[model samples]
Target: MRAQGRAPTTDGAASATDTRNALDLAARPLGGFEAATAGFTLFAAPLSRVLDVELSALEAQGRGQIVSSPRVVTADRVKAIVEQGSELPYQAKVGNGVSGVQFRRATLKLEVEPQITPDGRVVLDLDVTKDSIGEPTAAGPAIHTKHVQTRVEVENGGTVAIGGIYEQLNRDDVTRVPLLGKIPVLGALFRHRARRDQRSELVVFITPTVVGTQCETSGAGDAEAGKRGPEAGGAGSTRQPLCQ
Candidate 1:
């Protein structure tokens, strides 16, 4: 008969040790791999009443629309592209006196990397590029571009304004005694020509919201989900999440 109090076998002891190690590992939180995720909403609009208006007010007035709203993991790069124009082919010299037609894309692109700080603020590394086809030149159509690279920090659910991008409109109005304005050469004397130069600023508003954390347990995630409002992911809302 075996003794009532005998030491466990080596295999049993190793198995118990492995079970304890597994439990300990499971209890440990993920380290740097568990980065927080955020959702960013960007709006590009004319800087009219938007400067005084709140973001929701601006949206209600239809002065601005959401150009991009992306859910990105912290420290990861994300790109947003909104191309409203088409690619145009232009003649370019490829090699030794060899001219070839090349296509250029006119688009609005944004590259962003967001990092969450320990204090719960979000830091954004933003690159904004806006390209448009301008008036035709002697060679081909000109490409007008505006680019801005910046890094900014903001609290969660806060909006930041970026300016310095502008658009100019030139108009020539000729007012004369009706038929006199249509006269040939002599119409210059009777016509009153006026030039109006209007400049408008393009403002970009970015809002970031921390949505979730990778290390959140299921129970905590559920609790957070319950705390979210209808705007998060509820019904009757056509807008995307984190955008509203």
Candidate 2:
């Protein structure tokens, strides 16, 4: 991540005294005065995914081939799996043995743009997107997407928290008990079924701070220390000026 602070201008800082005076003013407590006439904008966003998996018997024989059944789980068509007939059993398994479940990770992306106002205010524009594969419907595995866009204004040196979006996904698994599990309606008695639901959330946080404020404080502290040097029995010792 890049820093959101502006660089100091070097137009015409001719004298050390002028520089020190500038630092002294910028270090002053906030009131109606402007501190170095500058400020900053901050942006942050959190992305997370929760995955749940459930396994169960489909109340029928678990087909080990890529059948046209909506319950059949396979890789994306773009990267579709091309397995031989001998590999069907291995590919259909959800675990060490063919259990009948599939899982995929969801993706989230965030984009933010910040603008600083003259009165030390910050404006933020945010965009968030999430993508995932949903449960099989009448057709097949459904593609799910969630999007969020918003703009807000915040005072300098302050923080803002914003909510994005949420989504839920599900996966199902099936299993059977040898030949007994295929006895028509009686098959369901020997099989097990399970399901998993995954929920996701996105939250964004932002903070803004003025640039050069740290430098000003350090400069002012050193200048104050120098002023008290003589009183501390260091009258003969020379004190360096701040900011030069």
Candidate 3:
């Protein structure tokens, strides 16, 4: 009987492109990878007669619009917008009045890491920070902060959302007379007390896609992809040559 030849095994049959991608990933440093982050603050307040007027004005200009005076502007942006005199405000604040209305702001931040695995899976490491600041009151600013770190494995082209919710108690006092407002027993007669319990949530969304070469092939592709023409295989084709 003639000796039989062995059939090809799928174990070591990875394509050159796949091998190159694996090597590239292994050679890359953590700093070489980059991610995109987006953040915003949401303000929530109890609807009062004074608040209604302010909200109405903001709506007329634009929803979520900010009205700030030049003198009261943030120190950081004072130099940049010195001439504008008035600009939209991102930070919430109370107007100089007796309503005692307060606006609370929610904050969010996120960082993501996508590490490629030889088996075509991605390891996702995430760092998240969130804070909800309550309006200043008789005591002080009410602040709640949360920090989280987590890791998960996902297939290529996947998305994840990480976040948390927090609640804070705020208090304000309205009195027509400044000196009389400080009195203990008699102050109650001259001042109106307002207390609010507010809740806020922070969330961050992240999506990752794998690239086979130093040049990106997704979306509009990299700068070289346009110049490389169809020979670059446009994207996802093995025949295209990768950047050195």
Better of 2 and 3 by TM-score: 2
Distance from true location, Cα of 224 in model 3, Å: 26
lDDT of 2 by residue, 120-216 (tens): 5655454545555655664345657666565555555554434434445577887889998889998999998889765543333334343442113
All candidates: CA RMSD (Å)? 24.2, 22.7, 22.2
What value of lDDT does candidate 1 attain over all alpha carbons? Answer: 0.52
Best by the lDDT measure: 1
Residues 1-244, model 3: lDDT tens digits: 0000111111121233323211211111234443323221111112111333543553465432222212211111121111121121234444664344444444444445456676755555656555546456564466556775665444444433333433344556454578887789887777776765544333333334454444333534455566786676545654443443
* CA displacement after TM-score superposition, residue 34 of candidate 3 (Å): 26
**Which candidate, 1 or 3, has the higher TM-score?**
1
Cα deviation at 5, candidate 3, in Å, is 54
- Per-candidate Cα lDDT values, in order, are 0.52, 0.40, 0.40
Per-candidate count of clashing residue pairs (backbone under 3 Å): 0, 11, 0
Per-model TM values vs. the true structure: 0.53, 0.37, 0.35
Cα RMSD of predicted structure 1: 24.2
All candidates in order of lDDT, best leading: 1, 2, 3
Q: For model 3, what is the alpha-carbon lDDT of residue 147?
A: 70
- After superposition, candidate 1 runs with Cα above 4 Å error: 1-85, 174-182, 185-192, 216-244
Top-TM-score candidate index: 1
lDDT of 3 at 3: 9
